[model samples]
Target: MSINKFIKASIQEEDQEPSAPSPQAESFSDFDRAYHSMLCAGCSCLCDDISYYMKEGHVTRTLNLCEVGWKRLCAVSAEDRVPPPSPSLLSDTVNQAARLLQAHPPVLVLGADNADEAAIRTSFELAGTFRGISLPWAYPGIRRFYERAKRFGWATGLLDEVRDRAESVIFWRADPLVTHHRHLSRYSLFARGRLTERGNLDRNLAAVASHETVIEPLCQQFFQLSTDQDSALIEALAHPGGGGGLDHRDLPALARALQGSSYVALFVDPEKVTYEALDAMFRWSAKLNTEGRKRMVILPLWDAGPNIEGFCRVSLEKNATPWGGPFAKASAGTQPEDTSWEDLAGTVGSVILISSGVDASPGNVLPKGLSEKPRVVIDPFKRTPALKDQVVIPTALPGLESDGIFFRADGLPFDVHGIEVWRNHGYPTVRDVLADLMSEGR
Candidate 1:
């Protein structure tokens, strides 16, 4: 089959059962709220101020959740095919997985950015035991910013701090209007901070993107610049008086506003940005701190799978850097080589994929041979595995079915409480499966 057709079929199969639209709040006056305060796991923000109404053990309506998140919460009643585990069969499966790990000298363990810390760490232990390479599934788009912050400590804090203290918020190559639906209303423009009680009236909002977004109306200044011109804009900001452009007479004024702000926060999105552009942003933030005596905090608008932050945190502690496969070290006897995604197929003998309720398909980056390898997939949903001869183990959803700790985009740990209603359902968590695998090896 063609790749396009396969992708289309996979998507169609994934969304086999569309959820029913939820009613308005006015229609639910008499319905008692069961899960009144809930945490949303849809986006990386992990918005915790959710009001969920339950009818007969299933979530019916959610208040204060964004449209995307509301739909995820409403999917609790979908015909999710989760089977009860049979001990004999599960043991046989785990033994088969363990044997695969033992046989494949340097297996590449991937995915689990959306899993809890426990699961992420357990997978690491499993890999370490077998001397295999473990890597994050999602690439860290804000790695440059993260590295800069760690190397040269930046004056930064959590989302609440940004909402309360920042006087000027600049979106550099970022469109929170799409990635984070409630970013403007909940944290920046419409949110009345402690000092800026007048909300957007008391703050300056600036954006630099290729095209306009829904949040353009709230922007104090919008610079419609091409991707190739990001460095030029940064250069102009660095030297505002140079007037390096023939168009947009307001560039100097915007630069002045950024320089003059008492407290400024820069929200960067690197989805379309290059490394040079990242370097310019780092330099821009550094210059702002050095020259003005006021520090500018750079926040990213990128969201990863649930526990990518946790994986990064652990990776930083152990490896002094956070990255996805294929990572390699200096020598064979030394740590494994810090590998890139492009180098995986040429190196590894086998692959162990963890689906984590998201995309389970092998990405196009994998070589055809590795892509065709018989593998193991751990996921909550019961969709067909991308590989033909793959072992599919059903697990429980993190926030809805299982309780664990997950970090927000800014690295703040949020506690997730699993529904007690799902405890008796006999579904396993990523941690459970990994732990059992590790235990089997011992």
Candidate 2:
């Protein structure tokens, strides 16, 4: 069958499903209700094709949204996802984020994976310029993989690109349906890409699942692994030669399955795959390339707040180091004398927290480097109160209340627009705050 006919048939299948027209919003004049691009960062699908139906003021109906997106758009409240943070509590945090690092810039800047990448880069350049630390964020693992990417090459392409170019997709410890609902529909499977032409040709998709999942049902091939079996697979993949300096035969099925592709796409969840496991997975991808696959691409899955991709790029520039760079290292930013948050709070003079999506309480902490001093926070929300000298300056929510370029897990650009559904004591961006702090010289 022709590629065009195959694509048409796919469309026909979608057309058969019940559908509704998007609400006509030609009359609403409210700024918040105005037409804006709706891209939910709640998950990795990073679905960019969202539109909203405005009622009195806020979104009454978010068109084409999935469950996660629907939950975010809807006012369904949860303890962890909806606790209103107080600036006062955060205001009471240690001032080390500013003061200690002010004397000698920090080297390692971790946690860029949690926030928007553009802002993170601002933080990175600040670190690098100040000679602050940047490396291995959140944990000690994954640095080698990052270093490898930096050395061999780190190529970034978007989900849209995958839909357009990918012929074979291999999901390693990744379930886009769970992690990113509608990904298969909007971007991967049901998506209409330019190359989807050759009919169901050799366009293969495979997934590794804990149980029969939404992914397993849809993939052309499935690898079911118990926790133990999964670990064994990782071990086998990592060693290739199976620990005893010989290739193990247990992975023959996986090896043979992988053999049947020209171009392949590999996706893995960073949280699930350890460094060694990830190394093995990459080795397999590399092997596929040498074995005559036309192309090879890898997509790393990361879980964080939002816009982690933009922050990574920004952090890399500011710190001369990537996000997850070392925060304890002197080269990243050294504050050896700075007291820990536990020791400095209440006793130390005051505090400041330049943060977003953080708990605003005494226990709600900053890094050891930032918690020792008294300071102020440049925030974008209203949260809990402080224990001592505290001030919470509200800021805007990236992509929601503010406009910027956000990045995906694969480090591709995602243009964002505002979507303010609630009250926020908005403050300036972190970059602006740093500029102000320097200008004031306080």
Candidate 3:
């Protein structure tokens, strides 16, 4: 079915569900009332202006949610949802998981990218307790970029800042329309901001990608180049008059556009380019700023789940590193290192998979040996063809069925309240489950 049809059907289905008075509902004359400022856990954008019209406990209608957010809400009642395990069974499973971690010297806690701030912190604590390692299921390129930023300072600003003051914006192999559905309307291109009072008209927009994208037509400049040409193109832009040995006709014009603007924001998806290309992009932006030519910043653009930033932040605070460690304890002061899928498969002794709504599944990308390791899966939905000898614990969907703190793509924190009561579903939050394991260990 088409996306629109599917969304329409999902909305219709939600509207048809019977409603009952919820204990949490506020006193209202009307049966249906709208709750505003609800955060959407669809992607890293975390659009916080969502409004849900609730009839008693059920969400009868919604406002400000994009197709991706609508699908996320639909998933709360998806037919394939895993039935909640009984409390006794849950206790037993937690005990078993604790025992497994205790036996495995270095437990690999994966999938923090999709978890809430509290759960992510708890995951690190759990890892520290068991002399384990915690890492987000993010692209290697992103990890590399973060590492590079520590060595050579990164020039970045918040998305709100980009929306307010940016005179020129370039989408460098990043397509927000597809990944972050509301990004253009809410934070970039079309949003009316302080200095950009005329919105798109007042700002210059450019896009660079390997293939055609939906955003290309909206951009004033679009560079469609081969995957290998990104480094050369960036080099050309970094040194405008030098040509940098590239023959792109638009290179001069693009450089001129950037140089002419007072404030420039370069949004890039690290996954779309190699480490060298990403580094060059950052350096180019830095050079532009240092030379006093323009106020330039390179903002990373990737769907690294909802709270990858939260995980990195927590890791930095607790481990003195953003994304690597089998530290014996929290705040061990270990230098951060990037962990690849191959390294994980070969090094980690055991696994604790925190499968939140995002696609945290290793799928076919991970080595077979990683799957063979003793594993514990905490997820809201049931896995097809369940793994052998692995414990699967059902959990509440973050930002939808549970209340917690989540960070946006720009490192801004949002206190997300659950739109639906989680207890009604008999599932615990990821934090609760991890806390249980920690208690079991004690």
Candidate 4:
């Protein structure tokens, strides 16, 4: 896609910044009733029903957000604010970045999952322009799923379809209550849809993991398998009669449920299961469709970040390849070794990270050796520079300070508008900054 085409068609120039209140409407009473509805870009579960109160061009309060979503919105008013740099300094940083791009070969444009659609597209463009590598910091299992999807296709449906038609829902090491608090209430078991008029009453829920979770009480059956035992459990499910350690009594019942359900939705947490295990589960689910002609599908529960799915979609559209690995080569060769984030950082001469509001709690971390290298981090919250020699460009946080498009967990794109403005910081979105860099680089 042309840069100008995207900017002109998708983004409105005025929407890049906060709109000052009209003189006639700038009353104290207006502040009290200045409620705005916007999308939350916290997790992959980008809830579009967020309500916030804008006071004097700033977001003062928010409602209808869970703890995870609330924290993301609250980043706008973080106490440790990094003051915006001067114009010359900004120019210098961008120039340095451009020079770095020009000098460095195979520069890794990392962190696409954390970015919005515009930024993701820009990253791929930059990668193509400079012949750099673009990879998402996603789980191995997620990456494998993408490859498998390309190789042998997948049976999937939208979250709304799950609500309306799924008679049975199985969660394998996926705890929606923690990872996505509103998932259960809004789209799954408890949600009342067209076919599932009675909500939880009409749906049969099952959980598979090493231990029980908050949803265990609602599950009709819980298949307990210790860590690294997913293979064993899957084998048990495949052949009910050849029961391994899994209780013989439960295997038959679980097998019966899998076969009986006309419409089943299987949710898997990539963080919890290995790539092989997940692949096995998906193949088995596919077999159900092939043999029994059952309506069974696999739904990934982990949201890599906002627009991670968008990155994958765009990558496929542009190059007919999946995301999360090295960028495509001119001539196809042996597959590259799967490099860890730490390993990639050490090998690459430079890295460009566009982590605006990305929260990495459990696994992602930058090694000190990698942090010691030259890098560019475009963030709005003035997060401390991770690298020793890095240009930290304070950019606007999408879904809050600026308007942009992001993809949901189910691989659907939606436009997110800027609701409140920050008068203190002249934060620009990743799109604008990248566009500027592109212009300057050329």
lDDT of each: 0.67, 0.51, 0.75, 0.68
Lowest summed lDDT across 10 adjacent residues in model 3 is found at 327-336
How much is the lDDT of residue 324 in candidate 3? 43
Model 3 superposed RMSD (Cα): 5.8
Q: What's model 3's TM-score? A: 0.86
- Measured with C-alpha atoms, the lDDT of residue 379 in candidate 2 is 51
* Tens digits of per-residue lDDT for model 3, 1-442: 5534543453443333223234355365444667788888778888878777777666666766776677667767777777777999899989988888777757778887777899999988887776677877663655677876876678899999989988889988889878887787677877889999978777888899988996776777788998788889889888877855888767777888877888888888776787778778778777777888678888888656678878878878986766644332322443233444655566667788877554335444345777788777888654534666577788888888888888888888988888655447878889999999888876
Could you say which candidate leads in lDDT?
3
Which digits, one per residue and each the tens of the lDDT, describe model 2 over residues 1-442?
Answer: 5545655654554333223333364444532463445776655456676776565555645555666556544422223332433554333322334454454333234343434555554544544544543332322223444554665454445777777777767677778766666666665566657886542444666777677865665566676764435556644533444542333343555445445544556776655655555555556556555655356777765544455555555545644444444445442243222323343232223333444343333225565544544445555434435534344444555555555666665666777665555324243544544444333333
lDDT of 4 by residue, 35-153 (tens): 54668776677777776666565554455566666666667777765666677877887888777766755566767667778787887777666666666666355567766665666
| Deviating ranges (above 4 Å) for candidate 4 | 1-31, 34-37, 58-61, 100-104, 210-220, 239-245, 248-253, 324-337, 356-364, 367-369, 420-425
Weakest 10 consecutive residues, lDDT, candidate 1?
Answer: 329-338
* Candidate 3, backbone clash total: 0
Model number with the top TM-score:
3
Regions of candidate 1 where Cα sits further than 4 Å from its true position: 1-33, 138-143, 150-152, 210-218, 224-226, 243-250, 324-326, 329-340, 356-370
Q: What 10-residue stretch in candidate 4 is worst by lDDT?
A: 9-18
**Given candidate 2, what's the lDDT at residue 219?**
60
What is candidate 1's lDDT per residue for 1-442, written digit by digit as tens?
A: 5534543443343222234344543465545446767886666677787766666666655567766565555444446554657877777888887776666656666776668878877877777666666676445464555655666656556888788878888888777666666676667665788987877667788888888765565566788888888888878876777634525756767777877777788887755676677777777777777887776887766645656667777766666667543255211332222334445555665677776443334445345756755566776755543455566677777787888888877788888877677656677788889888778666
